[model samples]
Target: MNVCTTGCDISSIHLTCGWFSSARLINPRVFKRLRYNDCLVNNGNRLANGHTISFQYANTFRYPLSVSSVRC
Candidate 1:
């Protein structure tokens, strides 16, 4: 699983995976979404496929047209 937080023009991310028998571990933050294959193999071993990954981006706007216009 992954967790993320953002503020203004900057953002941060964290990732972790559950313990497993395999030495390979994926960073949860690296993918905004993911999927797995039902069946696959290579070198007489099961292979991974159909896994999708994505990233989330934050948008920022600079400068204000009128910062004090709405001040009371």
Candidate 2:
């Protein structure tokens, strides 16, 4: 997942996911969740902004995946 603050540069946020992966981005200022499926090709991915953005995995999976993020 990803989080972008007000006036943040959306283009600077890069995310890559696998076939069984799902991704979302939350904007705290508007309390909205945006689903990004274009990158969904892998599995077991998660993201956190360490402030206003957080998430939870609803189900357990056996596939291994990696998590990464860039500061924007």
Question: Which numbered prediction scores highest in lDDT against the true structure?
Answer: 2
lDDT of 1 by residue, 3-45 (tens): 2233222122212211212233434434221212111112112
Candidate 1 wrong stretches, greater than 4 Å: 1-47, 60-72
lDDT at position 55, candidate 1: 31
Question: Residue 33 CA error for candidate 1 (Å)?
Answer: 19
Go through the candidates in order and give each one's C-alpha lDDT: 0.23, 0.33
Show the lowest summed lDDT stretch of 10 residues, model 2: 37-46
Single out the weakest 10-residue window by summed lDDT for candidate 1.
63-72
**In model 2, what lDDT does residue 12 have?**
26
Pairs in clash, predicted candidate 2: 17-41, 18-40, 18-41, 18-42, 19-41, 19-42
Residue 65 displacement (Å), model 2: 5.9
lDDT of 2: 0.33
**Distance from true position, residue 64, model 1, in Å?**
28
